[model samples]
Target chain A: MKEFKYVITDNEGIHARPAGELVKLAKTFASEVKVAKDGKEADCKKIFALMGLGVKKDQEVCFKVTGEDEDAACEALEQFMRENL
Target chain B: MKTYSGKSVYGGIAIGRIHVYKKNESMVRREKIDNPDAEMERYERAKAEAVAQLKGLYDKALKEVGEVNAAIFEIHQMMLEDDDYNESVENIVRTQHVNAEYAVASTGDNFAKIFAEMEDEYMRERAADVKDISERLLAVLGGGSAGAVQSQEPVIIAADDLAPSETVQLDKDKVLAFVTVHGSTNSHTAILAKTMGIPALIGTDVELEEIDGKFGIVDGLEGKFYVEPDEELLAQMREKQQAELAQKEMLQSLKGKENVTLDGRKVMLYANIGNVKDLPKVMQNDAGGIGLFRSEFLYLESDHFPTEEEQFQVYKTVAETMAGKRAIIRTLDIGADKKCDYFGLEAEENPALGYRGIRICLTRTDVFKTQLRALFRASAFGKLAIMYPMIISVDEIRRIQEIVAEVKAELTENGTPFGEPEQGIMIETPAAVMVSGELAKEVDFFSIGTNDLTQYTLAIDRQNPRLDEFYDPHHPAVLRMIAMVVENAHRENTWVGICGELGADTELTEEFLKMGVDELSVSPNYILPVRKRIRETNLEA
Candidate 1:
């Protein structure tokens, strides 16, 4: 299992569009990814779960990945946020 | 046999059986069920069928309008899958032994009723969505096709509210006018009707079923509907219709010509665009230039504020398309009413009076800076001018200039190439108008945001139902303010433009030209008419 922390850079924070984008990215990997912000954790594959976290701009969130592709998942998710979010 | 009068918001005369879109009642009948397991199975089957039916409707919509509009159905799909919608139907079907169709219909109707009863206009409009979904589901259950419009002749559409998709299906030549029991001027249906040149009267208390197949006249401009019109009234309406058609033909003839007055005083007719999606319409209208390019659409429907590159792509497209014609881009003017959860702006009690326009931009420098950088970058591609909205003071204008200077300095230091774009301020507030002489001296140009200006001058809360009656752009005070800004800007040799609904007012086009307003910026559809109006007027003293 690997855990990494990043701040949301998207202007709308982790709202519907970004959450959907994140979920789509998470589903591409075999690893189970969970995102948590301020003690609220959500399955990275579900848009509603990510939205429920109510992450705002610049707010920090942690991502934990578990599975054979855990390192790859964390690396890819981090890079995705850096590039797009 | 009842008649209620309202301002005719769109124009046409029609005689048709009013098809009262009543809440489907049969869906509410409860059935007595004996076996829980069988009931549950039946409920699931009904939901599946309804969902499948909804999917088909969505696919049809996709084929008709494109994916963005079809995406509106995604909300209905969500509602179908919602715990409240699905679970409610499931519980009723299981407990009452009702068929899945009946259960879903009943639950949908109940929800629609609740929404219809809501006091908030936005919430009340949700009832239409409920009705839309329910109607789609019922059609599926009945084995009827989607995209069905009544095949009757010369009908007037009366509904609680008409969705944009539904309104698009209406054949303008066949349908007379639209009368809605509830709708706002800003509703998608109204906006679309305006673009399509259809007459619509919204917010009427008249029940549609009572007037079905009745001869009626709808005056969209006056927001009035007349049922079973007398001979004299019908004759007068016919004459008026002929005059309007003649006027429209005259306007159509003015297309592809520059708007020069009778005495040869030229006035630029431009379009106020919200997004690149509207570019095609702008081009079709042969607009002189883009008067107001609302940049807020970039932030809307996105996860984050658009990056400089993303912003560049949009700005570049609009600027390049115009090909040296001016494109006045307004910075993000979002506030309480047009809130973005991404900005983390706290909900203000009075959003209009609260932190909005230049206020939000001033406070959130990071957000403002990003937009400035993008605008500066896009300036290289075309004739671009950055216009700030809701400027109430000279200090605000100075602060913005300071930031622009700072951004320019940074860009220079970083070796980023950019063209200098003219800076302008939207003189919307009473304070802005009051200080126009001082503001005119600082800015390259000025555009009157008359919508906000009128609202502020009359001390009327435009969103307040009680104050709507007082929200008039033609009020003497509002006109004087516009005249004031135009005079002030002209004195400084800076051009002034009017970029509000008033700009498109056919009657006021000559008045605006006389007031020394350099340009009138309106919606794309109004370009030809406004140009024609301008061409007919003698502006030169």
Candidate 2:
């Protein structure tokens, strides 16, 4: 299992556009990915689930990936966070 | 003429026959299905059909309204394929043995409830999206087309409410106006209507069935709908409609034209916006720049004081969006009539005259510095100018400059990059006008805020309706003060502008130009009309 954390810097947080983009990115990976904010966890593949987390600006969210491609997924997600979020 | 009143969403006149839009609202019935596999297959097929339809709409909207407005369709497509949403529908189909339409409808309600209960206003609005997609799925499953206008000619559409999908499907050239019995100002219908520049009214009491095919006049500017007008009223409205269309055509022609007088006296015409969302209107109206970007909305919209980073993000966005065009952002103008409980302000008998504008900022140096830090950081992106409001003297300008210098030094020490934004002051108070020459030497420019200037000079409480007769914005004292500010600002090579209501008054446009005023900033809608007035003015005459 590989995991990383990122604080949302986007003013609107994970809104419709970013949440849709995140789901698209997650689907491209073979690894089973999940995002957790506070104690609630949501499957990263689900756009509605990701948006339901309501991770606002300055809020920290954790992404956990588990599979043969876990390392690659973790690295890619972290980069996505830093670049886009 | 019989009349109905409603809240106006957009201002214009529409004289046309009414088209009563009735949505084919087929009720989804929950039915036991013996073949669960067959039912799930139906759901899958319907979902695909929904997606294809959404894709087509996305393509059409992209070509017509550009990407940003069309993005909702793209998002809707993604939402239709959302795992949680699909799972809920499929689960209902398998567990309860319900039909596909019933499953989809139930799931949509459940998900919409979640979004409706969200804390964020933007997220709450997503409830409508969930409902919209589900309706599309239901429509497809029922083997029916989504509710759309069948009218071949231009007509005012009257409906209970319009979904975004239904709204986008309508032929734009055929839509003269929209009147709804139910809808808020922020609804998708209202937004699309505004974007299409179609006059709209919501929360109207008119019965659609009764008014169907009736010749009606929608006076959006007056928020009134006149049904079955008399001959005299019809003739009057006909003349008014012609004038409206002519004025619209004239404004359209003024696009990309210079705000120059017949005698070649050039002036900068800009718009006053309260939020970043107003940028599109500013660009559409062809305003040279944003003269007054009210920064108080950030503070007002928040439960607590907005952090430096939050403030920085907004300022940066405005700067970047404006590109090289000057965006003069007025620093926190809270307190007084506009009170935020988060600011911990005490109620005063005379709140208008109490601690406000520069008063609050100067005393709360911590808040002031935080804002200045954000402003300077954002300035690196594009042309940004900072303006202080309700200044009364040179001492205030000097103190503000000292604080600004401290903020700059702090940024430098922290290895933060920033640009040197032009600093200006609002010459509003009588004291500010009296000492304009001395104060102008301290700032880059002077924006005469005529509203407050008139109230102060005349000693009339503008908020009081009793003083409405005495509250004359066109009072000579206010005009002279503006003229004096212009003269004083020019002496120190400082440009001056008017950012108040008087700025949009076409009667004063020529007089302001004659005063050698460098800029006039009005609301975005008035930009073209003011530009037209400026073009006609013969300054030499």
Candidate number of the best DockQ: 2
Best by lDDT: 2
Native-vs-model 1 lDDT?
Answer: 0.75
For all predicted structures, in order, the TM-scores are 0.51, 0.71
Cα lDDT tens digits, model 1, A1-85, are 9999997665556643345557778888999999988887878876445555667668899999999999889988986675445
TM-score of chain A of each: 0.92, 0.97
* Per-model lDDT: 0.75, 0.88
Best by TM-score: 2
Q: Per-residue error at B251 for model 2, in Å?
A: 4.3
Residue B193, candidate 2: how far off, in angstroms? 1.8
Q: Which stretches of candidate 1 lie over 4 Å from their true place?
A: A1-85, B1-3, B7-19, B22-71, B77-98, B106-131, B163-165, B170-173, B249-291, B294-327, B330-526, B529-541
- For model 2, what is the alpha-carbon lDDT of residue B425? 91
**What digit string (tens of lDDT, one per residue) describes model 1 on residues B1-541?**
3456665555544444454443333444455666767766655665577677556656765544334344445556655555556677778776677666677677777877766775555555666666666665655555554334465665677777776546765555566677888778756566556545566788897877677666677765555677877788778877877778787667667767888988988888899999887865676577888999999999987788888867866786677667788999999999888978898889888888999988889999998999998889778878999999988888988899899999999988976667788889898899988889998899899999888888888988877798776667689999998888888888898899999888999989888888989988999989997887787788655
Tens digit of lDDT per residue, candidate 2, span B411-517? Answer: 89976778999999988899999999999888999998988888899999887899998877889989998999899889999999999999999999999999999
Number of clashing residue pairs in every model?
26, 0
Chain B TM-score per candidate, please: 0.56, 0.70
